[model samples]
Target chain A: MTELLARLPETTAAHLGLSLAALTLGVAVAVPLGVMAARQPRLAGPLVGVASVLQTIPGLALLAFMVPVLAALGLTSIGVLPALLGLFLYSLLPVLRNTITGLAGVDPAVREAALGVGMTPRESLVQAELPLALPVILAGIRISATWTVGTATLATPVGAPSLGSYIFGGLQTRNYAAVLVGCAASAVLALMIDGLLRALALGLERRRRRVTTASLAGLLGLGAIGASPAVCTLGTRDEAPIVIGAKTFSESQILAQVLAGRITEQTGDAVRTVDSLGSTVVFDALEHGQIDAYVDYSGTLWTTVLGRGEPRPGRTELLDEVGRALAEERGVHVVAALGFENTWVLAMPRAQAERLSVRRLGDLAPHAPRLRMGGDYEIFQRAEWAALVTAYDLRFAEQRTLDPSLMYEAVRSGQVDLVAGLSTDGRLAALDLVVLEDDRAVMPPYDAVILASERLRRERPDVIAAMRRLAGTIDDATMRELNRRVTEAGESPAAAAAWFLGRPLPP
Target chain B: MIRLIDVTRRFGDRLAVDRVSLDVAEGESLVLIGGSGSGKTTTCKMINRLVEPSAGRVLVDGQDVAHQSGPRLRRRIGYVFQRLGLFPHMTVAENIGVTPRLLGWDADRVRVRVRELLELVELDADAVAERRPDSLSGGQAQRVAVARALAAAPPVLLMDEPFGALDPLTRERLQGSFERIRRELRLTVVFVTHDMIEAMRLGDRIAVMSDGRLVQVGTARQLYEAPVDATVRELFAAPRRQARLIESRLERGAP
Candidate 1:
């Protein structure tokens, strides 16, 4: 219990730091921007219009959007900055709008009186205007703080550590305890910050002044002190199936969903992942024994997933070689590769490529550094990309790695000169990012494979066979268009998966 | 010494204060008396430039009020009000210290000044300095308001009916206090009020107005003794006498 409590503080600190930083950063950017806008009426409307538009974008899409942008900038830390940027954007309206509203609402008489007193504009604002406007300004701060804390929970998707981890991870793995802890802690944090700030507001009103923000600091400190007693008891239960987990892309989620889904279906037993796992988090969880099994790609297994050295080989031979090596090396098993090839193919704008006379990977090597490269999340970071770059000496002025769904748009928008896109993703055709042939053969086959904990093979061969039913059946053309409809056409992945399994297309 | 030269203040076509000229010499207290909407308040406010005249100019000690900007101008001119618009945020001392602080008085000077002003207003400085405006009594707040206006010893004080809201007893007490303060400070005061008795008691000189136009201007005795027109005779000094007679002798006759 003491150990658990100790860990709890660190966890809570992480959440608070992320949430507060998000709130502060949001206020820092938005208030000044809003002030500028309000002063220039023409600017204020459109500036806020842009912020409101940001809020209108879905939370998941926005976080996903930050992944490649931040990753390209080399900011792939598994915590606050990613989440903070998103929450900061989320917190803008309350602070920005309220600041403008509060300051604007000050009576004209008071402003004139302040000015009349020979106060410099800055002095007048502090002594006369802001004092009168304090109640309203404090109101904005309270709202922004509460909002940032709440929204930062969603950062768990992009490998951020927060309360949402419990909810999403628990949902994935069926671990209600971890979910309960995550949720309960976050609620307390939001409530605590809200209460303390409210007290400060009330105290200032009656006394007509403020002291140090000690009241808020005290609560945050107390929360830390209170969190110290729970860390030890949860002691590296990291070995339990409930402990280790991973989140890759949709395929990883679907594979985890299918495995966990069928495990409960057949045996009437449930084990939930403690937190929702993202791409890097899944590997970390595997290394920490924080999760038991996850489904990743064979080519990813060769390059990124396993961090293997590059080799010159064909699709089938390379996959086989990588699969054999991983079993020998990592003490992990490839139960099966789903009936599909999730290969990374460099795509270009069809018309643009034709016009440029660029036909293949080697054909465009000279222009590589000058062109823009767009690809999926893992592909840009993979050895396959490096080998392709090294083999063809490919370089581009800009490189963008995006979600498989957005690969086409990156090319469509002319934002990228080349895209390392999935061979089977349907978005390639829909958005017109043409697949340039990899004539140099530097890339390997990426068969969708379900890698599991060795403990699982000794225990559950039935689960393996059930998953193998999906092995090597989904072909490039059939799978490509299906994936496109789900991502690009906005259909559900579960519905898409159901349709894929309904066919006898797998060999 | 505050003077308004042919001041015409118009609010979107209605002449709030028409081209009226008035002068308040140093050490002289002038009272502007009229019913509401007669521009009594507007004329006093013009001396401070609170209400800018649509045409014409006001001068304080020969310096144009329009040109005298910033704390230098404000520090030299004090303003009081009937309701005593004391800021709710600051304590009594802080409110009283506004003008001094604005004039860049040192902290020690402000302390001493605030203490002396509180003493002059008959408030215990120590008790009131830490207390907020809302916590102070109405009479107390008003005294603090007077102290605030007098803090920097502005040569000219424009008061808009400073005692209009007080009870008659409190009004009489404050009037006595003001007379003493006026002699010691030698301030050029412009007081606005509708109460004829208050004007007679407080003002050395009186200016009466009707419909945004000045009807009469003279010493209080001169206005009362001569009363150039029937309106002046009926309105200025008779209202109080009528109230007294009607309440006593006429009460039994009416019954």
Candidate 2:
């Protein structure tokens, strides 16, 4: 709990920075566009239509889409940039629509009176039309602000640190307290921002200068404080920080911390981790030099990166081919294999497996017609699952996609008869589940290998050397124990990683 | 001070005002009396270039109105709308000072002018200057609107039924106040209204319009005694008939 609280300041600052920057930019772009549209009826339809279309896209998909869209434009594709762009786009519809509506709703007589009183078109707008429309425009901004704060929680998956990091990391590790804290904090932040803006609108409507000044100050002051961390870092840092990437699971998070610890110890370089990234996003980020290093499995590279579907190679051959293909074609360096294979394994409750006599993949074929199966979100979509189905001719009565953390509990509690789980997942032993043997050797090797970007290898070879020291350091038993400490004993990934390195916890 | 020579206006295919010509001398009050769509309002608007002429020319102070920008030309001409279009967002003082401020008068000058105009319109400067238009009664709001028009002290004033929205008592009171201000300032006035009695009461000369054309322009007595057409005669008949009805009622009550 104390550790989670310690992370609160940094995460809250990141969340505020992303939301406020996006909202400020959103207002800068949207207000003028809205005014132009309000004047030119021909433009009003298309401008508002485009913003409305953007609003229809689901928020998470919008953030994820920025990754590739920005990459194609040769811009920053990960971290805060993509997240900020996505949030800015989301904030446009409300502000733009309200600006147009508010101006259109102004009394025509009042408008004519402005001209009658010798006001120029420009003066009429700035002095009369805008002042009258202010309350409505402020209402739109309030809606946009609250929505931006709430949606910023989704930025974690795109490699931006936010309050969402707590939710994503906590859910994967079964730390409910962290999730509760993230949810409650974000709700409070949204409410406070909303309340302050409402006060500003009321002040403007009632023409209270003191109330307006105070509320406006409160709003900008909060934004500045939230954005200060990012500003300070940009001002002070002389060299770019080395960014480590991690997938959205406890094991990957631990491995990333392990890499971060080793690099910092040996090279004394500034290290930052962008965690909770999707599998494909992490690989694409590394390929584009958005991240310096991450841990990936050999089987993922062979199937997903190499696009190989047939003729599974020997374990050693598979690792060598993956390394060669990555280095030659993608300019990625294979730093080291961590000497543990966390491959896909079919698991069932021990008592259930014993009762059903399902000792091997081949043995499951007869019972598959009656049993229900479950797997993590990605397993049912992978090539290895297809290979197993064809090799064993297995057809389950029902198959469910579950979170990686929850699948063990699902099978143990009899919600599923079988689950395709990682071999090194500590829950396999902790819950007394038996692994069904791949008697035909249909599955490919999944040796954990460290991969570094081409830029990192060239520019920071010492950092790469520091990472190479981790070669064959963590065997299957040791890796399983590290996972056990997080999944069962409720330890954080950083604590488990520190234990492995034989060092005290950081801070 | 104001001249419209063969001035015409068209809203797309519809001719709102056609080839109407008139002139107002300096310090003269000319009232335009006509029913709805009779082009009286459109003719008045052309003097300030609020509605551009589709044909012919409009001249103010012997200079063609089109020669200057609309805002610059409008700054030199005072106008009051039929609806008394006071800016709801501005205080009474701000609304009155709008024209002077737009004419680039300094802050102290605008402030002094606002107070003087408020006094000229018989409004309490301290009580009403800081209040918004929404807070004022019908008579007070109408006074503020007139004060706003007279702020920059333009030579020409165009009023389009300025008291049409007020109750009869309020309208009468405002009309009296306006006549006093107009004479005191010697403003060249072109007032538009549908009320024949009001035209007779306030206008030095009344111009009657029908179907976007000026049918007659003369003093009230000249038009009443020698009307050119049935439209001008019918405009005069309403007031004459009302006078007879009231006279008969007074005679029967004499006992």
Candidate 3:
């Protein structure tokens, strides 16, 4: 709870910046287009059809899709730009639809009156029809304002910071307090925005000066709050700080902090972190130079990227093979191994394991049919899961994909007999779970390696060299302790990384 | 003066106004009397270029209406619709002041004109100027609509059933007010109405239309005494008989 409060200012800024920017831009564009659509009957169907189609895309997928699409356009694929664009697209539908509806809904007699009063079409729209339709259009804006706030939370997974950081980070670390804080803040923000818009709508409807003044004042105050962070970010665009990314996990976040801290310390260069990226997104962003560097597990890249199902004889051999493959094929240079392995592992509660006498993966086959296995959403789709299932000949009665945060609790509470656990997860030790050994070596070494974009390698070799100072610096216990600080002690990854590096905390 | 030369307006395949030709003299109140769909409203609209004629020309003051921009031509001609389409979002004063302001009148001058029009329409300017249309009575709203149409003091006016939506008592009162105002302003007006009684009461000359063509154009007494056809005679027959019966009763000193 304290951690969430401490981080409130930055996250609140991000949440407001991205959501409000998108909304304002959305209205600016959609309203005029809507008016044009209303005027031009020939274009009305296509205009509305396109906006409706955009609305049908799921919010998360929409944000995710922006990363690569922006990259393809040779633009920044991470940070607030892509997020803003995605939310803008999402915010467009209601405003456009409502503008069209409200304008169309104006009484024909009233329109005649406008024309009869000698108002040009433009003047009629500006002075009479728009004012009359203000309430309805504002109602649409209010809907979009609330929706944008909620959808902005999904921006975190696309390398944009928002209130979703608390939710995504807290969920990954099993810290529900942070999630509650984020959800509550977003709901309050949404309500505040909606209330102001409602006031503006009422003012327009009744043409009351006092109501208009109060609502405009309220909206202006929020506008300042929302615009502040965005202004700051855009002002720094010329500097273009190196963007470091992390996937949605405590270790990933901690590793990103370590890299950022090291680069700042050694090279004295400006660095920015865009954390909570999805696994594939971070890699794609790096390749496109939207992000300069991020830490990835070798086994994950080998299987997911290379489509190689075969496991090598040893950890070093696998690492060497994958590292060479990445550099040769994709222009991604492996800076160094961070000397920690966070591989996938199967685990059960100690009591359940003892009761079933399950000491290894082979020993679980007999009981697998009666058991329900739980894992994170990606586990079922991974090659590691397939390899493990084939090696052990194991099939649970049901395989449920739970969030990473809930898997431990599910296994601990006897809701599930088994789970796919991360090797370095703090909860694996905290919950007294027994990890089954893989005798067949079906899973390859999952050494965490720092990978840099080819552009970064070519342009900033000094930064890479500085980052290599941390090669073999963190061992298994050290990595686990860092994770524990974030997941259990409520320490932010920045603070944990600073503590581990014996340096002052970031301002 | 306004003239429709072979003016024909078609909405799709249906001819709303078919080859109608008429010349309205200066300061003449030409009431277009017709049943529903009789093209009276279409003819009125053509004067302001609200609806362009498909096959002919509308001339205002010896100039082609199409030569001037639609909005510019409309600003020179006042238009009042049946429903009294006063802008609900604006106050009565603002509604009345709209065209004068559009003509670039200063605030003080626009305010004075709004007050003058309000009085001309028999409305209390002080009481109703700040009130919105929704707050006004139907008769009051119709008055404001007239005031709005008269704001810029256009020489030409086009009214389509301006008092059609009012109660009989209110309608008669408003008609009397309009008659006095029309005479005072010496305005050239093409007033459209379906009611023969209204046409007789308000029009200097009434142009009656049936279907999409002009049936007869004459004064009330002229049309009453000399019937163009039975339809035109039938239109005024009942009212003429009622008036004569009432006159006979008065002459005999009967209550």
Question: B83-129 in candidate 1: lDDT tens per residue?
Answer: 57676677778888898898888999999999999999888988889
All candidates' lDDT scores? 0.70, 0.91, 0.89
**Model 2's CAPRI class?**
medium
lDDT of 3 by residue, A9-33 (tens): 8788779878888999999999999
Residues A53-138 of candidate 2 have per-residue lDDT tens digits of 99999898899899989888988799889999999999999999999999998899999889988899999999999999998999
* Rank by lDDT (best first): 2, 3, 1
Better of 1 and 2 by lDDT: 2
User: Rank by DockQ, descending?
Assistant: 2, 3, 1
Best by DockQ: 2
Model 2 reproduced share of reference interface contacts: 0.74
Evaluated on CA atoms against the true complex, candidate 2 attains a DockQ of: 0.75
Clashing pairs in 3: none
Error of 2 at B37 (Å): 1.7
Q: What share of the true interface contacts does each candidate keep?
A: 0.33, 0.74, 0.78
**Worst ten-residue run, lDDT, model 3 chain A?**
A498-507
